[model samples]
Target: MSAPADATASRVPAGPMARFFRRLGEGRDNSLGLLAILIVLVVVLSFVSPYFLTATNLLNIGRGIAIVGIVAVGETIVIIAGGFDLSVGSVMAASGMIAGFLVTHGAPLPAAFAAALAVGALVGFINGAIISYARINPLIATLATLAIIRGLGYVISGGRELVISDEAFLTFGVGQVFGVPYIVILLVATFAVFAWLMPRTLFGRYAYAIGSSAKAAQRAGVPVSRWRIVYYVTCGLLSALAGLVFVARTGNAQPSAALGIELDVITAVILGGTSLTGGRGRLWGTFIGLLLLGVVNNGLILVGVPAFWQQVVKGTILLVAVLYDELRRNRVEEA
Candidate 1:
């Protein structure tokens, strides 16, 4: 008689690289492929443009996507934990406007900035509560918040762009630490911390557990509602951080800031190889994927691609990433 299939599979021995490839096939990692693609992209771009591989251009690419990278970090977390935050772009705009409005009204800079982050977290908490407790679909819930927050942004800014001139605040956008831009530093640090948390901490493990099988996790005594909310809150806070950074970099808070950024964030996460079905993905993949995105956009501009055509290219990449993930996963797991 043959042994049970599951038991037999459990006894199979595999080397480290073998295990990684197996998991890669299971939608657990895409960094290997993403890295290779990024390298090829860089090489090709370098051939087309003499400035593409220059120090200035490399740093420019890093700075160009720094804010998006920060937001994508948070989105990567929520996606891995089996949720989405479509409101991120709105949250960023709202938070930036909140800080801008407060600072302009004679409030202390620190206080105003803190308030922005607080509001971001509040919005996130609302999102989590709606999904985990109200049992609403995560997509629908966040999509609603996205509009609400953006409306509030318009109301807060009176539909005008607020110019910010505070030198301290502006320094983060302009200053460099040991020759690297502050925004890039923030991006790298954010990714590093979250990357560590996802694999080395209980919080990260719980995220995977919940994402992989919420029902099973609940049966094993995990607090599903609470943790799901935590994930959104974390995402919200980071979204807020990204917003502040955007305003600082651009030197103004526009009610319309971060418009259409949701696509960039989600596309970068998907391109990084995270499954829309959840319970899979890694930050390293997202980081590389983001660089790939930055390179493509920058390269196109250097080669004289029109703005509308550039947008078309972005949309195509996003579509392909989603299709690839869907084909690999085959089915979405129940929450």
Candidate 2:
């Protein structure tokens, strides 16, 4: 009897829940936690605001977040590879103004569009070059670019808004397929492309490796500088694309557009599980975070919350996200 009892005790195995929790602690299932919170929010909001679950309101939320959501994808890639981009908002303003100015001056729509994109890519390249090649810290370098780009935007606009009257271009903002706005489709398409590419491609692997330890990745033969520039360029292109989208939606280019938007993108990315220190996060997490923020904002509006209060809430959420990332990072280092 004693021998049988010992065998049974020794054979006892860890259950599925325990394994799940272990993986969660290791940070592999962060999206799962975020997903649960999203679902709970949906449930609560559906009850709190009678309009929250309506199709029109939901679509409005999608449209509201599409710009930030699109930008966040590129930002996610940058962050994962141990980089930062504070110039996204400024780039958007500048790019939109560039396109608007050109087209309004009788430049063909295609040419103006291409010009905007090229300018954005150039700005990104410069930022990447300054940081990666010139060895300036990313925070300081991108901050400088942010100021420079915003200044460029104002200079181009001459402190006046560019009124866009092109119907073809404006359609991109309001056009819909199957009752879904084209902008929303764009957001989804971006998410899908990145989600597939990030995990299954060499670029993705290199990004993670670089973020995990740039010195180690360099020793392992990764072209660290080249890839860093490429990532920033991609971010720039995406930022320009977002600017075009903004121009279409608003039918005008204001130098002030997208001001302070970078902070919002950073907030969404961090909330989605991307670490400020880099090397850990997912696009899906960012997507969920985007929706969560959108829904929360929409809910607050329905509940008649003040605009200033919304800013305060957003700031608090960002702080919490940073704290969580710091705590998790510390725990990982200890482990």
Candidate 3:
């Protein structure tokens, strides 16, 4: 009887908790786990701050993170392709200044937008070309361009803010539909498009392949150089688009706009589980990361934390996320 009972127990499937832990050990719970963390954070913050769950504040959070979320989408793409763009913040300033300069000079709204996008695309192309063809390190390449682009922005804006009064142009920034902010809508749409693009398109597969192993991708006829350029250029264009939204939201294009935004974008991307080493991430993860940051920022302010301390918290979070990512990478390699 004892022998028969032992055989029957051995044949039983694993329980729910066992399966859950097994999946987690296999590293399959990344995004889902992050989402769970985000939910807990939201619930806790809501309880700690009465204003947190208010509709007004909720909408405000959406508006606040709109630009960061938008630029982060591009950063996600670039990082996934095993590159970085430290110049996105600078590019945002330059692009916005270009559009504001044009609008103030009587350029039509469409023309102004076109010029700004062109500037962004041109800068992106340069960054891509240097990295892909000249074989420059992405960090050094984008950092150099960061300074150059920022200087250009200062020169173009004459070291001052370019304020625009064009209602038509401003509408893009301030407009809303069905009581929802246009900027928020734009952010959601951008994420939706890329979310589709990444999993459903060959371009996404090529990006993953390149990030996994550029040499292997090259051998597989993945056009590593071309795709790299495409990723950087797309990053540039998206950063520029975010700049336009920034200008709209703020009603001015200051040369200093989006300063340090790259840090926030990169931090969000990494926190969202997009590997800093590349090739393993999801767009939705980035979105959740953005929301997490936004919630923390808002919660801190609502709970009366000083502004400077918020920076400290953000920096600490970024460091921890990076360290965890490195450890996870090591574990994956060892496995």
Candidate 4:
């Protein structure tokens, strides 16, 4: 009888405590796995191309990823809250044009920059309002606004590129601080703020809760609509900031600037483990995703990959990342 009871106990499933420990172990393993992959990629690239490890090349990589990373941070927030903003690229273009117009009219540098940022926030606010108040889907609302904003950009520029000739602004575009590019510094600051906001604040927790389960969050007294709007507005504000950087870097506002940027921004966010279905993502993951793409781009160039092939490579990587995320998600669900 004792032997039969022992056999029954052995066949029984693990308790919650045992399961929790297993999950914790799996989480650590997954984290280490990603870190190992990153290290291997770095090491392999350095070996394959002598220039891949150079300071100058690393700086180039940093610069390339900076804006995308910034935008991805905002995207990550909105995604975490269970929404999408397709208009971000267009907002970037519009905000840049707004700044150019202000500067051309003798507006002070600071004022022009602020005005540009305001435009971006306003656009975001509009998106949020339409989605929440009007009860429209986020994707549809943002897509509509995207078209409208892009059209407005063309009208504002009279179908021309507004050449920015401001020396001060140009300085910011090319400036550096403490051996790091200004763009990189800006990206770091943005991420730091977001990193704190998402994990430590009421708004952040509510945002994630809402994304994870809107109905449940609502019942729990979370302000779903209000926080959703805030996320989109924040995204808009960041996109506008990216626009300023673009104008500063390029010294021109073309209606076509940042074309298809939304896709790239989303790609980075998704690659970083942010789910499009919402509720699961990390700002750090988005940062890593941006770096992964940035490194691939820079490394490809160093290896003499054709410019067109670069696009193909990026697209392929994005697809693979998405697939991997889906598989991982399904596995988690099954477990």
Tens digit per residue, CA lDDT, model 3, 1-335: 99999999889999988777776677655666667777998899988988899988999999999999999999999999899999999989999999998999999999999999998899999999999999999999999999999998788667999888989888998898998999999999999999999988987998888988899999988889989999999999999999999999989999999999987999899988899888888999899889989998998998899999999999998998899788789989998
Q: Rank the candidates by TM-score, best first.
A: 3, 2, 1, 4
Q: Write the per-residue lDDT of candidate 2 for residues 1-335, one digit (tens) a residue.
A: 99999999778886988777777778667676677788998999899988889999999999999999989999999999999999999989898999998989889999989999998899889988998889999999999999998987778678899899999889989999999999999999999999899899988889999889999999999999998998899899999999999999999998999988987899899999999988888999999989888988898899899999999999998998899889888888998
Task: List TM-scores for all candidates, in order.
Answer: 0.91, 0.94, 0.95, 0.90
lDDT for position 7 in model 1:
83
Which runs of model 3 end up more than 4 angstroms from their true locations? 1-21
What's the CA error at residue 162 for candidate 4, in Å? 1.3
Per-residue error (Å), model 4, residue 106: 0.4
Cα displacement (Å) at residue 265, model 4: 1.0
lDDT of 4 by residue, 226-280 (tens): 8898999999999999999988888898889999777678888887778877888
The lDDT for every candidate, in the order shown, is 0.90, 0.91, 0.91, 0.86
Off by over 4 Å in 4: 1-32
Q: After superposition, how far is residue 312 of candidate 3 from its true place, in Å?
A: 0.5
- Mind sharing the TM-score for model 1? 0.91
TM-score of candidate 4 to 2 decimals: 0.90
